[model samples]
Target: MSSNPGQEGAVAHHEHESREHASHEDAGIGRFFFGHVPEGVHGGLKQYGLLAIFLAIITFVEFVIILPEDLRGSSIVIAPLVILSVIKFFCVVAFFMHLKFEHGLLWQIFVAGLVLGLIVAIALVLLFGVFRPTPRAFSEGRQQPFVHHVEEAPHYEPLVVPTPAPLGAIAPAPAAGAAAGASPGQQIFMGAGGCSACHAIEGLAVGALGPDLTHIATVAESRVPGQSAEDYIRESIVEPDAYTVTAADEGIDQDFQQGLMVATTSSLGLTDEDVDELVEYLMTLR
Candidate 1:
C-alpha cells in the first residue's frame, strides 16, 4: 500500500514539535536551579567545572600563604588573603548564584544591601573602638634598667622566715638588704600571664599579633598626659582597650587593628599583685 505525502508530513511535524517542547522544558529547569545564563555564554557542565577548578586553586593558594610561620606573623600576608577571599566571594555570587545574569532592579537591590552591610560593619568597629589607637608615646631620655642574673649553684638556697622570740628570749636582727634576683613581673609575663602570645618584648616574648614592647617602659610615661608610667602600664594590663597600640608604635608597616588583644585582666587570671609586678618589670625595659 502507498502512504499519503500530507499524512507523512504531518507525523514528522508533530515529532519536531515534541522535541522542541522537551528542549524548552530542560532549559526552564536549568534556569530554575542554576539561574539564567547570559547570551553568548555556554552555561554548561564544562563551564561550571572550570569555575570549580579556579575556585579550588584560589583556595589552595590562600591555604599555602598561611602555612609558614614567618609569613603568618608578617603584616604583608593579610592583604593577599583578603583579596583572594573577595575574589572568591564575587565569583560565587556572580556565577553560582546567577546574580550576574540578573539586571535592573535586582542589581540595584544587591548593591544597596552590600553598601548598607559595609556601613554597619564600619560603624560597629568604630563604636566598639576596635581599631582605635591611643596617641603615640615618645621617649626622650630614659635609662635601661638593670637585670640581675644569679650564678648557678649545685644546691638551691631555702627561704628563711624569722620566728617570734620566746617571752624572755631576744629577737634576731633583720638583714640589712635582700639579695637581688629575677623580676617577679618577668616570670609572670613569660609564664602565667600569656602576654607573650600577642606582644613582643626583645630577648623575651616573640609574639607578633600585637605591638612590640621592647621599649614600652621608656614610652609608657608619655602615653597619656599627666598619667604616670606605672598607672598607664597597670591600666593597659587590666584594660587592654584603654590604650591601643598602632603599627607605627610597633615600628611595623601595616595598620595594626586594635581590640585584637584580650580586653580583660580576668582572662589572664592575674591578681592585683601580679599586675603590679608585671608593670614594674615592663617599666624596666628602658
Candidate 2:
C-alpha cells in the first residue's frame, strides 16, 4: 500500500514550504521588534518580554500600595513594604540577573550569600538592639559591695618610713591597693564584656580584633564634638551606638555577621559585671 513516488515528493515540498513560512515570520519578528539586541542573543529574547511585563506590574504595585489616609499612622505600611521589596529583589535576581538560566552552582552561591547576609544582619540587630547583653556589675546590682582582703607578702617585709608626719600630710599608701581591690571585678569584666576580645589592653591583652586602648582616653577627648572624655569611654563600651568613632577608627559599620565582629553578645555570652567592668575601665582610660 506504499504511496507513489510522485505523491511523496509533492507532500515533502508542501511541508518544507510551511517550515519556510514559519522561519520567515520568526525572522521578521526578530529583525523588526528586536533590532537593538546584540547578535549573540538567541531564543531567550522571549523571556525578556516576560521580564519587562513582570517588572512593570511590580512597579505598579509598589506605587499603588500606599496606606490609606486614615490608617497611615498605623504600622501596617512597613510590613507590606518589606515584603514587596523582597519580592522585587527576587524577581530582579531571577530574571534581570540571569540567575534563572545560570548554572546550578551559581544559583547555590547566590542563595548562600543571601542567607549569610541575613544571618549577619540578624546577629547585629540582636547585638545592638534590645536584646543587648547586660554587663556583669549591672546584672549583680551596682550597689553590691565587694570586700577585698590584703594579701601579705610572706617573703618580704614592708619598708619603714623614717620621717614623722607633717601637719595635714597624707601618708603614702600601698602600691597595689587599687589593683588588689578592683582587679577581680575588672578581670570579670574583661572576660565577659568583650573589651579584651576587641581591644589590646596591656594588662588584659586578649584578642586584638579592635583598636589599641593604651591611649584611647587621651585621644577620644580631643575629638571635635567635645564630648566628655569619661563619657565617650563609658558609652563606647556599654553602648557602642553612643558615638561613631571615625577618621582613624573605621570599624563602626562592620556589625554584620559576615564582618569581623560576628560573635556579638547574641551569640557570645556576656554578663552584666562584664559590661560594667569594661565600661568602668574605659572610663578610666581618659
Candidate 3:
C-alpha cells in the first residue's frame, strides 16, 4: 500500500522528536565526564551545564596530574594546569556570571580584569625562579643549565654524590680516576644532585629559588642554636620544613611550592654513604 506523503512526514517528525527527547535525558553525569553535550538540549540551562562539565573535566585532570610525584612541580604540568584553569575561569565568568550575555563594555571590563590576573600569576611564577634558567656544574666541573632537558623543574635525580671523607674526618680516598678535588659529594651537589638548581654557592652557582648557601655553613649552626653546622645543613636538606627559611629579603613568609625539593630528596634513591658525602661537601661551602 502506498503511504500518504503528509502522514509519512508526520511519522518521521515524531521519530526525530523522540530521539531528541532521549538524548536530552541521557545528558546526565556520565555525559558531563566525557563532555558530550546533547544537541537537543538548548537554552540557558543546557549551555551552562555543558560549560560546567568542561570545567569539571579540566579541574579533575589537573588534580590527577598534580597528585603524581613527577608532574606536581613540573612546569610542563603547571603551565597546562594554569591555562586550563584560565579557560574554566573565562567560562564561569561568561556563562554562570552572565558576562557573555552582558553589554559589550561590561564584558570587556571583566575580561581585562582576567588578563591582569593572568599576567600577575605569570609574573609571580617568574619571580619565584620557576622558569628561570639556572647554571649547573657536573661531575667533571662542566657547567650547564640546571634543568637542561626540562622546560622547567622536571624530575631531577640527586647528583651522584661519590663517597667523600667524613664531615670531620680526613679527605677520603677518591676512585683512581676521579677529578681532582671534585669529590663525589661535590659532584652530587653541583651536578646530578641538583642543589645548584635552588641554591647559590660562592664561586659555584647562583640559583635564586632558595636561600644562598654561600655562608650556609656559617649560619647553619647559629640558625638553630645548638645544632652543629653540619647537622643543621643536613637537616635543611632532608627536613627543610624543620626550619622555614623566611625570604628575609622580601620580609615575608610565603608558602611557595619549594617543598618539592624536600619531597624529591626524600625518595632520592641515594645510599646512606652517598648522603654523608653530599653533606660533607655542603659543610665545606664556607
Candidate 4:
C-alpha cells in the first residue's frame, strides 16, 4: 500500500529529532566541561557551566569559613567542612574526571577504590591513635636535669591497670630526689601509660612527641598565671583538651587534642593515687 506523503514527511522529521537528541547525550562530559559552544548555539554548555560554577562556589565558601572568628573549636565546623568536601569530590570525579561517561565496570572499580582508600586511611589513623588527644609539646631551655633511670630499652607496654585500687595500693610515695625503685607512676608512664612514647623525661621515658618534663615543674606554676604547679600538671594529665601547646615558645605546655589523652587515662583505669604519684613525679622534674 502507498503511504500518504504528509504522513511519510512527519515520520522522517520525528526520526531526525530522535537522532539529534541521542547525539547530544553521547557528547560526553569533556564536551560539557571544556568545549566552547558558540553563543546562542544550543548544547550542554549552559548545564555544564552551572555545575562548574557551583563547585567553584563551594570551594570559595570553604576558604571563607576559615576567615571567620571562632572557626576553631566550633561545633558546626566539622559537619559542613566534611560534607562540602565530599560533595566537591563527587562532582569533580563524576563530571570533571569524566567518570560519569565511563563504562559501568570501570565506574564500579573507581568507586570501590575510592571507598577502600578511605577505609584504609581511617583504619591507620585509628590504629596509631592519632585521633586521640595529642600531648602538648614541651619547649623549655636546652638544659636538662640529671636523673638516674631504669632501662626500659625503648619498649612501651600498653597501659593495663588491672583494677582501680585505692590510692595507696598503686604505690607508696618515694622520698625526695628518689633515684632508686621507680614508683607506680613511673611504671604507668613507661609501661602502660604510653607517656614515654611522646614524652622525654631526661633519662627516663625519652619520648620526643611530647614536652620534655625534665623541667615541667619549674614553669608549671607560671604557665597558668594564678594556677598552682600541681594543678597545671594534673590538668595536663587528665584533661589534655584544656590546654594547647602551639609551638616551641610554650615552655612545658603541650599540644591539645579532643579525646586522645582522655582515652589514654580512661583506658588505664587510673585511680586517685595513681594521679597523685604522677603529679608528685612531675613536680620533681624541676
Candidate number of the best TM-score: 1
Rank candidates, lDDT, best first.
1, 3, 4, 2
CA lDDT scores, all candidates in order:
0.62, 0.51, 0.60, 0.60
Query: Please, what are the lDDT tens digits per residue for candidate 3 over residues 50-120?
Result: 77888889889888878878667889888988898877876676557654333345655755786899899
Per-residue alpha-carbon lDDT of candidate 4 for residues 17-48, written as tens digits (9 for 90 to 100): 32222222212322344342322224346657
lDDT of 4 at 5: 34
For candidate 1, the 10 contiguous residues with the lowest summed lDDT are 170-179
TM-score of each: 0.38, 0.32, 0.37, 0.37
Best by lDDT: 1
Q: Model 1, which residues run further than 4 Å from truth?
A: 1-181, 263-266
TM-score winner between candidates 2 and 4:
4
Give each prediction's root-mean-square deviation over alpha carbons.
20.2, 23.3, 19.6, 16.9
Model 2, stretches more than 4 Å misplaced? 1-41, 67-75, 133-286
Quote model 1's TM-score: 0.38
> Model 2, 113: alpha-carbon shift in Å?
1.2
